[model samples]
Target: MEAAMSTPGRGLTWSLRGRGPADVPVVADPGPWPPDSGGPAATGRGVRVCVVDSGVERDHPAVGRVDGSWVVVKDPDTGETSVRPTETGDSCGHGTACAGIVRRTAPECELHSVRVLGERFSGTGDVLLAGLRWAVEQGFDLVNLSLSTTRDRFARELHELADQAYFARTVIVASAHNTPVESFPWRFASVISVGSHQEDDPGLHLYNPSPPVEFFAPGQNVPVPWLGGATIRTTGNSFATPYITGLCARLLSAHPSMTAFQLKNALYLSAANVRFRSLPSLPAGEASDESSESDEPGELHRSRESPEPPEPRLAAGADGTGN
Candidate 1:
């Protein structure tokens, strides 16, 4: 567990320590639902999960319902909405893919789709900050940030906001960046950084293998509902983050009093560890068993390690596509 200290003019300073290399082991593909792995029905029945990304196809089969949503960006030159289903939707297909994962893991959770990135999947930090603030104001239990920027100043402010929200007990989950270089916001210690793994392709190793990845979710060529009533296979750290977010919703719904820190610890402790042949140096940790009650607050204690390093993998395909 990483703690944030105060830094002058830097908002909050996070000194990450204890995080050694990524030591979590890889497990056999658990074949969709792990046996007796209480499906979405066991968690997140009524929780509200706010996804701040490019916009979701609200009508997608996986997206059974949306509680609320809005467009946060528009083309400055054209004066047209940049979010989808109007003049906007997921042109890059990243946002839709992420939304699908969240819906898959938390079918009953109310989704609030906030379109901060435009159809082009590009937006300034101000747009993202505004979307985050709005989600906090709306009282969402979880905020999923599938996109991030390289801007340091914006990243600091976003971290501060996330810290404040976390103290308020709102869970914030971010994709461990996919870049070969570090990305902001996701690098912030206050956010639960997620990494990618291939459930079906066990041969495919995890992406951005790092200690910062608190939990791993399916990311390689996962099936997602696409625009125009189509289904496409995609892969990225962006898609992996939603699985964590959906799981957070489930945990939060089951234990309404669990703090953001506690929920994060539950995930790390619950993760099924497997040894990757490519990274033979890392040791395997024990995976959480069904007997363990992850929904309970204080089930797992925090660690003393400094926050893990920022995700080292960059988003695929587009430079600024929302996650």
Candidate 2:
């Protein structure tokens, strides 16, 4: 079954372009209390993040606490439990790397380690379905899916799960799979698809390199604790998805009253667009502008071609509106 699926690749291009070292900035610094200075703070303190992938190491220095966990792998012969702490775990290292990113951004969020992938970093669609059902049952505030499969039916089921999570006030964050071509589930509209960005590059910072990349985060050369006895440096959109997941946790904690749609809009508006020198190498004679006109804060700009969506009416519990 694993052979029928596409193997995940490395160095997938993201919509936002930036060039810099791969180290993600951790939220912890000055004090236990929230600093008056504007900076990333521990806004995920009281939230629960259920990470659905290969199992997590409960003792890693970077992972502060494990509120809950489970293993879903089954035996091939007797249909018995094959998943144990000593057996089915994150040998592939992708899951742990993503979990680390989430931890960095939202240190206070409690992690729920739900192991869907086994020792080989492969699993059947049934395994994934079971994991997500369990996650929903647990009522997590957020769930991070760092794995991908090409099966379209499975992807649809996952989308339904995301919709259920959204209405239940649970956030679902998944990796925009790293491939020569786009992958499903991540490409699905309901899930918050995250793409990787190289930190510090000026050109790609402001614009997206791909569609449905709601946000960008550090994913290249990120150092993360792995299974067994060592830590490794890794890169991919798989690692970047959790950064947004953790960020969502923090944002939710700060504004517990906001809905999921409001939270998503806030992230889109907060992103900084870097000035690109040129439209990225378009086909022959494709006319494009490299510069944008600066507008004053609170100013509205619209093209004459089409009408914009109606502005959302501000509600009592909604966050402030934006462009």
Candidate 3:
């Protein structure tokens, strides 16, 4: 069932290349918010994570204990997409790789998979939409979208879906296009878009004071699970996305009630780049938009003291459009 596939972009660069770590201000106080990514005890035990990709292998050593699996099928004559349970495992090893990363980061989180791509990552935009819609409807704590469509025709619908999920409190962690290009879902403000850093530390994540891409994680030449119970090292914005997703899972484990807005705020506060001063009070636990429908109650600001090199910009969502 392989078809022409959307290519995963490679080499997303968001780094302050020349500056040493000491130069950048490190603020340990991530506001008065509940513990987030750096929470030492949170292992994502109660979180339910959905990996919407080419499907995940059930018993792969690197990706142990998958909770569930599904595949999106399209009827040839009707051209409609639908979900069905499957035990066949990964079609292109992409989903397994992503699941493995999530497992490594959030070992206790229940991992689920929804296959939306075929071998070589071949898939259609409609299927991507269908799989994502189902994943969102399930109300999973976090959904990882490591794949995206570059087509402008799908943008509006995808944006709507992303927003819908945002309001539903189904936090979506999407990958930025590996290259500098227009991509859906990631560009929207509703989803937490991620890019890659070359750092070997899987636990190290950075906040992009600048975005379409909001966060950066380990993605370059990352060692991940492949097909046939083997291990392979690969790199792409896709890999980086799951790392952020896992972090989101950990955050949710600790808070258990944080909304998408507060989750994102937590991320911004925990970001290694930001100089955390006493942050303004945020809504303790507002579920949805309030009196006015907008991104947030007020703008979230980051303080950058002088003499520090500018934050590096690479990875998904670095479109610079601020959309």
Reference-based lDDT, residue 212, model 2: 72
Candidates sorted on lDDT, descending:
3, 1, 2
Q: lDDT per prediction?
A: 0.64, 0.62, 0.77
lDDT of 3 by residue, 1-323 (tens): 01112332333225667778886774432322222434334567889999999889778999999999999888877987789988879888999999999888777899999999883334458889889999999999999999889888888888888888997889999999998988878999999999998888766678887787989988999999999999999999899998888877776665566788777866664556655333445578855444333334444345554312132211111111011
Give me the candidate number with maximum TM-score: 3
Model 1 bad stretches (over 4 Å)? 1-41, 74-91, 119-123, 199-210, 274-323
Clashes of each: 15, 13, 5
Q: Candidate 3, 312: how far from true, in Å?
A: 27
Worst 10 residues of 2 by lDDT: 314-323
Clashes of 3: 5
Candidate 2 lDDT over 69-117, as tens digits, reads 6787666666544433333445466666667767867777788878887
State TM-scores per candidate: 0.65, 0.66, 0.73
The deviation in Å at residue 156 for candidate 3 is 1.3
lDDT for 12 in candidate 3 is 26
Which residue runs of candidate 3 sit more than 4 Å off their true CA positions? 1-40, 119-123, 277-323
